[model samples]
Target: MNKSTLALAVAVGVLAQQAGAAGFIEDSKASVSSRTMYFNNDNRDGGADQKETAEGLKFDYLSGFTQGTVGFGIDAQALVGIHLDGGKGHHPYPSSFFPSDSDGSAASEWSRASANVKARFSKTEAHLGGALQPNMPILVANDSRLLPQTFEGGTISSKEIDNVTFNVGQLEHAAGRASSNSTGLAVAGGTEESNQFRYAGADWKVTKDLTLQYYHANLKDYYKQDFLGLVHVWPIGTNQSFKTDLRYFDSSSDGKNGDAGYQFNNNGGFAKTPGEVDNKTWSAMFTYTLGGNAFLLGHQRVNDDGGFVYLNQGSVVNDNRRSEEAGGASFYLFTDSMINGFVRAGENTTFGQYSYDFAALGVPGLKASAAYLYGDNIKAKNGTSPDQSEWERDLRVDYTIQQGVLKGFGTTLRHGTYRGSDTGIASQDQTRLIFNYTYSFL
Candidate 1:
């Protein structure tokens, strides 16, 4: 173990020995969770077919703050991934589903552990060490595979003022879902290591149904970004309501991004200078909800300068052997569809979804939804000026035990199909079946 990991373990051990220290032991909680997943992908244009199955075991432990003006606590997680079935057909080929060996085969098993040390004072808190996962409009951790991505960072959050919250953080490294080691941050076309990522943001609740947000972030040598968002809800009656959401982002290249080894691929999309980061994006979404039914529609547009850019480890092919260690990441965007993100440069996308809950018809624990998205006016490379286009459709269903011994057992099914013009990605279909259950001990 490294210094950070060892220090976290020692801190937790010392804190656990002081079990009689008021809130520390009284509010402690533990849980064990399990997941079984089967994944299948069919490439319509004669690409490789993928089929695989995996099982995951996860354990969590959380301790409440001790009784004091400035209290201390700890949180720890253990994750284990077991490859149940993956034949030659399931080889790792440009995906993060499983760890890839020297021969491109999936590993039989992999595991990792993480911990966090936290301190609290009044309505504000500070956390340090690894296992940091932040869920904000600017950055989201991926949890779609056997394990969730984690970051090595420190963050501070304050809610001391009513209806206002503030957050700031600095991240040094990231560990992918399938790897055990941490690596420096980089984008999709750059292999240069950048260890500094700083961000600050705040949310203001101006009214009972309206909220506004702003955030600024810098990935040291890659790019800088700013985001603004607004949300409002209007009650239409006793059982109906309408919600509106608007978001905007502006991004530009940073220091090393103009140099060698620090170029961006733009996700294979069009770029004014081939490898520069220069873009602006905006989106609007509205939804109406009545009882157990919901209808949502949205539109998004990407400026003509370049494609949208976010943190991507797949571009780290020339790094310190950290390619597989930094694979999955998520960003907040309406067009982040199931199979494709649909954020190519100069692209305009329209999307909608309809969903229903079976509980409205006296059957609890079941829900279903379908969504579709279409993108047009996508810019092409080589200055061709031809407007390329693409589309995707997705369906999802979920059920959970309502009132039995397995009250929290859950099952989910999802399917998606993607097709595009000759200048875009090839056609494909994907499906996933997932089973999940959790047990708590206190």
Candidate 2:
């Protein structure tokens, strides 16, 4: 245990010894999940072809705090693993959250753990700590695997007004989902550090059917970002409803935009690039629901330059690593999902989706959905004007027994197919399946 962990344990131990104070743990929720994944790829782009299978086990716990209005809480997580089948040559990305070394090979096992301390009030809460994941549009901690990614930061949230909420945070470091070691800033060119990583936002309901949101973020020497979101819901009939969502982000702020310094383009020995990049990103998605069926179509675009900036490996003090961030479009960065946490740095994108709920079909807690996305005119900085195109198809099936011998048992299966013209990374196809169970212990 590190010094911080020891300090927390001591504090909790002391509190538990008080007159009427509760034990260190006020409440606890536990879960265990399993996954079987198959990944294969035939890259005609010179990288080694990959074909492998993996199995993983994850144990998660969310703990509550001791008694009192001015309470102190600690949240900790632990992940363990065993690599079923992956070789050095045909190594699959680790079954955990992050990618292994560029070599593609992975160790037989790996794990990650994180924790945080928080304080709360009637309508406001503040947390200052490390080893936690923050998931938001502007700065999302990628958590799409057996183990979720974590970051070192502090965040504050307040709901002191009617139909309105506010959030602000500052992050200084990031730890990938599969590793226990913490790393410095990751930006465009390389890793450096400074007084950066600050963000703020607000979400408000304007009426019965409309909601408005705004967000702003900065990454020291990296690019700064601003975003606006609007949503509306309308009832088409007794069983049909229409939902509309629109969002936009601005790529002008500190760093290259906020007057911090210059961004890297070709790496000509600190000489500086010629011009600056300003981005305007927007997306509109609409979903039509009828009984157990839902159909959705959406469009998202990223203007000239690139996508928003955040932490990366080996990067500190905020820098731009446009080396692989070929852009001109903006759909991948805004997609929120249960898999593949965040997909950014692409040009124009168009997507269509359909989902079915078994509840309307006589089964409760069962649902399935599939989506397809296509992007083109991707601008690459490596002098390769290949108007490369890529497409992805995803399917998910989930079933939870409404009532029976096993009242609340559940299972989920996900399938994905991705193929593209040498889009910098190897093209491939993948499939994943998961089995989960939850029991109440109150």
Candidate 3:
């Protein structure tokens, strides 16, 4: 068995011995969540369209720490995905949404389970397991599909100091949102697994209205990246406020990064050194909120040397198989929209969004948002073509039952349209409708 599996077994054994412990049984929590999604992607540029529907069920159990100086507990998760509908031609081969069977068609169902051993001491906590979902500035687990992605690794988070939080982790493998198997970490176009992704970061709340962050990460044999961020909020009145968020990243190649087996695709964009990673990106966003309405504006710039880089295992083929359809990822960026990420080399993008909550209009659980992004001056491959440009527009609406028997039931609808000029990226329109519900058991 793998190290994570063995660790889980040992932790479960310990839990069995301490099943009736005071705090462990008294403060435990359990929940089950269900999601049903209908996804439709229309390729405007002659590619085959993808239309599919699926249902995902997730069960989670979080045990409270045992009563002691150094307490121990466990977190377990089980997920199952059922393919409800997708015709032969609609279910694309090598899809990022569902696993394929022997005939290259969507599989009927798939399932996976994982557990984490956790310990708490004073004001710090540590977790070791295969069901880790981290949401730090350096990494964000993807959950835009029927199921959420997960990582296999160990993480330590501490808030021992007042108004300061520290985080460190080392991730070895990833299970994609639509996948059942785990694969080692790698970048785009990289076929060889790296197996080591280490990161350290800290968030400091300098004041009640201001916060600062810094983080550094390295994927062995791939790339190293550093991020710095600042956020501040100013309250103008009882129901008025303005916020500013600024972020910067510097990334460069690591050992064997430009080698044949460890190439970076630069998100299908132009790269100055071909397969090497060398990038500097920055973004700034401002938001103004008045009552229940909010407006946001942002600008992002990518250096002329290369496109941004992040950990992705989509292209890695493990053991002559494609890692059980392990594909799709998310990056921490304002432009990581529904259809496209305007992160090409030498690209400068400006974006804006408007959102409103219906509670101010007498509706308790309704919200809607509209966003638009325009990018220009994208470097072309080999400098042979004219500079490229792209634009995208997105619309989303969500509602939830605020009361009654299905109080927690929610529904969301999203649509996006993307177009590019002289860029290799595809022009497309995409839409998704999702239904979500959760039940808690203590």
Candidate 4:
């Protein structure tokens, strides 16, 4: 049966159950989960180098559905982070994304929380209110925190058709996980109002092994973009498989980000031009797997007179996708890099990565990956030549037990090395580790 039919059946079952119950309480569900993490980082040389140790706690709570043809629900979260230690002031890349105290220390502690109300009907869902997070490559929030970042806005998702999912949203503001205030978003290298973001998208499953996705977004007066993606996964044999993911992006200036042939008003860092800006980028990655081992290869190229990449000034796209389709998303980590290891802004760059999974080796859940990125001969139209070379190496290993005393508990280790000159800034080596566990009581 098709997925839509399946959902219809489920909905009917739920409604039938609701009709026979003491309201919707018989079908209601609620739960609270906590996540704790210990983090440490060390950066060498440069005033931007980082050396820090910290701890974080996050609480996730959900309230079951309420009565009506449109069911109502609520979800709330709270996050608290504490500074365990910071060395020589610059550790934690102090000068980059975070502001340091006169003493060069990170936030002694920081916290943020949000709540959202959701309504569901048939195969559609809508949400509104304080919880801030709506992701798009052109407007992703920086959540490298032990706690996830959020945005304030309104969004709707619909799955009324058998093979399609549609989404639309309007984001009015954002609240950084470490900060409580709502801030407008702007592109990294432009001067304009970055608030009032908007987006829409569709996902269609064409076949059991193929899926197609399309998305369009605008960051207020900053930039407008469209994304086209195709993905396929096929099994080669009992123990072998192959998968491919390809994407294309087209970008142009919007409102203030667009030059009106007028001068002196900076739209972020982008300069006013006789005409608006246009950028195009395409990338594809494929992988083949056998047993517990896998090999991947991918390449991405950007063509534009200027830095063709667009990133939210305060958020970063370091090595993953801006969309939260899954727990671990895809990123143009190599397309453009994150400033301070998280922000992105640059031009003329090409990159690739390789990874492996250990689940087939009786490890239940374990995986590792390593990546290398390089940017060279960066030239811009009205901008100076960043005639320099920058490269980075990233490594990660994670494992989670399947069935044991510590089932569901997991640990991850990550490390990175970066070196560069010119254009936007400095260089360094960094490391991060997170270990945590989750439990459910419903």
Candidate No. with top lDDT: 3
User: Roughly what TM-score does model 2 have, to 2 decimal places?
Assistant: 0.79
Candidate 4 on 241-260: residue-level lDDT in tens? Answer: 99998888887777765443
* TM match of model 1 to true structure: 0.95
The CA-based lDDT of model 2 is what?
A: 0.60
TM-score of each: 0.95, 0.79, 0.98, 0.79
- Report every candidate's CA lDDT: 0.85, 0.60, 0.92, 0.58
**Clashing residue pairs, candidate 1?**
none
Tens-place lDDT per residue, model 2, 1-442, is 5344465566546544542446335465666666555545545456665655555565666555556776666665666655566545775343233236545466557766666666667778776556656766676665455455566667888999989889998776665555555555445444344435888998899898999988888776666778888889998998899999898877653554323333532111111122233557678899999999999998877553544344444323323432111111112253543322123334577888999998997888999999988766555544345555567778889988878777777777877766666555455555555555555453
Tens digits of per-residue lDDT, candidate 3, 1-442, equal 7776787688778878887889988889999999999999999999989999999999999999888898889999999999999866898888778888888889999999988999999999999999999998789888999999999989999999999999998999999987888899998899989888999999999999999999999999999999999999999998899999999999999999999889999878889899999999999999999999999999999998999998778889898865637878888899989988899899999999999999999998999999999999998977568899999999999999999999989999999999999788789999999999999988
What ranges in model 1 sit over 4 Å off?
1-20, 317-322
**Candidate 3 clash pair list:** none
TM-score: which candidate is best? 3
Candidate 3 C-alpha RMSD relative to the actual structure: 1.1
